[model samples]
Target: MSVADIKKHLYKAIEEIDDEAFLQAVYTIISSKMGPGATYELSADQLQILEDRREKYLKGEGKSYTWDEVKDRIRKKDGL
Candidate 1:
């Protein structure tokens, strides 16, 4: 599917999910886009990290975080 198609389907799916799942899915996508940087645009270090992570992921050596982990991290950073 095209990127647009995938995004559309993702949006549709999230709209039907419970609040927690939706937040988690959104966080996962946003985090992946963030990589090792503060901006959506990748920095050199972030680009290298992404490339290495992709390679590790393809080889089943990558890691992942749960939705709760991300939510809590953000909350703490913002003093929520």
Candidate 2:
């Protein structure tokens, strides 16, 4: 199905919904993710962790892996 078709179907389904609470929940989730003014605020601890990681990366102390290597690790961990 195309993106346009899925959006039309969703619109029609949402139009048929009568429960205000369920609609509000759906609206909250969609607005939080895609609304015009939507922005995520990270906590101080999260910011500090990111800064530490950046410092390590700049100092060549952080390890990095290729996408295929990461996928292989995940597959091995999952016994796939």
> Ten consecutive residues with minimal summed lDDT in candidate 2?
32-41
> TM-score: which candidate is best?
2
Per-residue accuracy of model 1 over 1-80 as CA lDDT, tens digit each? 99999989988987887899768878888888876765457689999989999999889889777999999999999999
Taking the tens digit of each residue's C-alpha lDDT, what string does model 2 give over 1-80?
99999999989999999999999998888888796657567899999999999999999999988999999999999999
What TM-score goes with each of the models? 0.34, 0.52
Error of 2 at 19 (Å): 32
- What's the residue-level lDDT of 67 in candidate 2? 100
Where is model 1 poorest over a 10-residue stretch in terms of lDDT? 34-43
Off by over 4 Å in 2: 1-30, 33-38
